[model samples]
Target: MRGFTVIWLGQLVSMLGTGMTNFALSFYIFEQTGQASALTIAIFCFVAPSIILSPLAGALVDRWNRKVVIIMTDLAAGIVTLVWLTIVLTNGNLEMWQIYLGNIITGAFNAMQFPAFSAAVSLMIPKEQFARAAGMLDFAGAASNILAPAFAGALLGTFGLVPIMLVDVITFLFAILAVLVVHMPQPAAEMIPEGNKRPSLREDSLFGFKYIRERPSLLGLQFVFTALNFISAFGAIIATPMILARTGNSAASLATVQSIAAFGGVAGGLIMSTWGGPKRKVQGVLLGMSAENLLGPIVIGLAKAVPGWAAGSFMSQLFIPIINGSNQAIWQSKVPPAIQGRVFATRRMIAQISFPVAVLIAGPLADKVFEPAMSSDGWAAAIFGPIVGTGAGAGMSLMILLSGIVGVVIGLVGYSIPALRDVEDIMPDFDALTAPIVNNEPAIQSQGE
Candidate 1:
């Protein structure tokens, strides 16, 4: 716990720095282009490469030292930030291409960093404390979200983007230093039977998919989250545009709404860390999703003012920590530490695969389809105009509304599935496996039966 605590603190600072930079960059881009497509494209560049390469990176993380993986990836990301700073200092201007390139490079590194950090945490913490530990991690992210926008907003007005980038580079250095001083345990080497060869890298990479496919409960949970991610991306991607459009492109209003929404995440994380979650962790996940969808986008779509948007945003983020923390605890307990990196990576890739696709389409959907339809004289005006009103952001609002409704349905449908509902009970904890470390693979009964 002590080692985990130190790492958590350092990562917290790093996240804050990164968040500040992201906020500043997003604002700058949006203010310049005033286009949702540009922002979505930038986000796509950052996410697509990571999702595509997660399996290979996961395999490498399992084979390499976890601490080293974390250190190197963090260092790489820091160097990328430094390069951007240098370009900004020298050139006195940044092009969209530079931002896209940097995002691509750092995204590749994150594919390795995430799984390694998750696997390392599993080794460091006790099984019973998994949920609490996950809560703390979420808390770190939530705290960053809460602080970044406010700090970035003030600094961007006073000092500019250079200072924010410098802070990000410094925080990355602090994170690397923290990792340098900590001791991380490695998974024991697998023992091969006489005349039997070890698994190849391809086999190792594919193992995570194979393992999940054989477990009905785990597979069910993955499908639910995959759908959730896909549906949620539509609304999430368009949120900034919706707010800006409604507020006549007011940056202060956008910042206020974002900060308030992040406060909800911070509060949720604090509660989860202290009280843990429901006894049935799946309940926490499903119920949280339902509550969030009902309270968040639905309300936002109905509102035309900053207060309403802020309220909706707050509710939208409040349950995120509970959903994520509970879900993470389940995975950490069910999967043995030895293969967690690959399994978690595969899990992440599958769960988030829809996100990039949704992001890619969200901009077009909002800008082309929905917005025009919801216009005063557009086709959709007769049907949805009375509810959401006919205007510039009305079509995007309709899309957000539909997304929330579908998200609620997804949660409700997940609850109806017995496998996902009883995943914790259906699958034994890693410690309870008969041969938990057989050939560096978990030896558990396949729930496919």
Candidate 2:
């Protein structure tokens, strides 16, 4: 736990620095290009590589030293930031292509960083503390979300992007130093028998999907998240536009709603960290999701003012940490530490694949279908106009409301499935199966073992 705490603190600092840089870069691109598409493309460059490379990266994480993976990836990302800083200083300007390329490179490194860090945590902390550790991680994210933009906005207006990139690079160095000081445990199973051949990369990469497929409970859990991410995407993409359109493009209103909502996540993370979530982890995942949808999107969809939007946003963000922490704990407990990198990476890939798809379609659904239908004299006006009102953001609000309804139904349906509901009872904990030695030391037996 001490080792993990040190690493966690370092990573938290790194996240803050990285978040600031991201904020600065986003503003830079938008300011320079004056095109939303430019910003969107930059984001796509950053996110797409990670998703595409996750499986291979996870396989590599399992095969290599996890600590080394973390250090190297952080170092590489830092180098990328350093290069960006150098370029900015030398040329006094950055091209869009350069930014996109940097994002792609950093995103690729992140593919390895996340799985390595996640797998390392499972080894460093006691099994029972997984949820708490996850909560702490979420807390770091929430804190970064709240602080980064504010800091970046101030710095960008004064010192500019160079200072932000320098800070990011320094944070990476600090993170690497933290790892250097810690004694990271390695699973004995990762060490192959003397004469056995190592598995092929293809086999290793595919292993996670195969492992999840063989476990009905794990597969069911993945399905639930996939559906949830898809539904959640609708609100995520449209929330800003809906708020702005309804408020006549009031940035102040949007900021107020977002800042308050981010606070909810911070509060939720704190509570989860202290409480360590529910005894029934599945309920923590399912019921939390249900509550999140009911309280968040549904309320936001029905609301007509900033207060209502803020309230809905806050409630929605509040449950995110609980749901994520519980789900992560379940995966950590169920999967063997040796294979967790691949399994967890695959889990992430599966769970997140829906969001981009939904993002792409959500706009058209709002512009072409829902908004038109809900227009003052549009076809849906007769039916839904009275409830959601007619005009600009109304159709998007209806889409959000529908997404929430479906999200709630998905959570409820997940609980009704015996495999998913009784997942904890049905699947034995990995520690109970075999007492694997760590760091080449003697195996420490679990109580069940």
Candidate 3:
């Protein structure tokens, strides 16, 4: 508990630093290039490499000592930040290409850190506390979301990017120090699934996919997330535009809506931390998703004012942490600690696959198809125009409303599926496998005497 607590606090601080750097770098690139494309490319560089490398990273996480992996990732991330600071100082400015490269390098290392950290948490904390731990993690993310943009914006105006990067480096040092001081527990002998037969790296890497393929319940759970991410992408892609259009393009209005929504997330995380979620994690997940799916879009779609949108958005955002916290708890309890690295990585890869595709299609869907149809004199204008209004963001609002309905349908359909609804029952808890670790000694050992 102490080890997990120390590591969690360190990582929370690290996340804030990372968030500041992310905002500052994106701000710098956007300001320099004066082009949204350059900013998007910078973001893609950060994300794509991590997605591409996750399977291999997960495999390596399983093969190596997780504590060492955590320590090395912190060191590597710190070195990356330090190098960027050096470049900015030496050159007097960072080029767009250099920023892209730095993001890719740091992102690749981060791909390894997340799975290793999650797997380690399962070993460090009691099984009953998994939801509470997940809630705390979500709280950090929400807090970072609330603070980072404002912090970076203020600092950038006063001090600029170098100081922000320096702050990030210091936070990484704290992270490294935290891991160094704590002894991470390992899987007991009985918990190792594959006996002593070591395979090639490629085989090990693909094992996560194969493992999930055999488990219908886990696969069903992932499918639910796939649908949710895909549908949610519509709202994410158009949230700002819709707000701006509806509010006569007021940036302050959009900011206000965002701040309120972020506050909702913080509140939700706090609630989950206190409640520890439902006994049936799946039930909690379903309830949260149902509320989000039903309330988020409907309220925002119908709103003509910022307060309506903000209220709707707040209600919607409130469920996210509960949904995620409960879902994380289910995974932590159901999956064996030794193999969580590979399994959770596969989960990440699969769940995220649909969102990018959705993002790519959302713009065209809103502009060419939806916006035109909902024009003042167009076909859908006659039918839905009166409800959602006509022109500008009307079609996008309609799209949001439809997307919410789709999410609700997905949640209902997912719950109707026996394997998914009964996932907790179908997948037995793995806590017993981890109960015998006498201390935090390394549990890398052969099976069956």
TM-score of each: 0.95, 0.86, 0.83
| Per-residue lDDT over 66-125 for candidate 2, one digit per residue giving the tens place of the 0 to 100 score | 999999999988999999999999998789999999989988888898889999999898
Question: What would the C-alpha RMSD of candidate 3 be, to one decimal place?
Answer: 4.7
Count of clashing residue pairs in every prediction: 0, 0, 0
Candidate 2 off by > 4 Å: 25-40, 86-97, 156-162, 191-196, 241-252, 363-395, 434-449
Superposed Cα RMSD, model 2: 4.7
Q: For candidate 3, write residues 1-449 as lDDT tens digits.
A: 78888987888788778877876776576457643346546655666667678889988888788999989888888898899999988987898888889878977887888789899999888888889888888777777656765677678877888888998899989888889999998765333333345456887688778878888998888878988888887876566567655666454565567667777777888988889988888877876787897888877887767888888888887888889989999888887776788878887777777765676677667767887898788799989987889987788888888888888888888878889888998887875554433123344455533
- How high a TM-score does candidate 2 get? 0.86
- Candidate 1's C-alpha runs over 4 A off are 191-195, 437-449
lDDT of 3 at 398: 88
- Superposed by TM-score, candidate 3 places the C-alpha of residue 345 at a distance from the truth, in angstroms, of 1.1
Judging by lDDT against the true structure, name the best candidate.
1
Write model 1 residue lDDT over 1-449, tens digit each, in one string: 99999999999999999998998888878787888888999999989988889999988998889999999999999998999999989997678999999999999999998899999999898977888888888888888988888988889877878999999999999999999999998876643333455668998899789889988899889888999999999988898888887778776888899889988888888888887888899998987888889999888888778888889888887788899889998999999887898999999998999999999999998888999898899999999998888887888888888999999999999998888889989999987876644445544432210
* Residue-level lDDT for 410 in candidate 3: 82
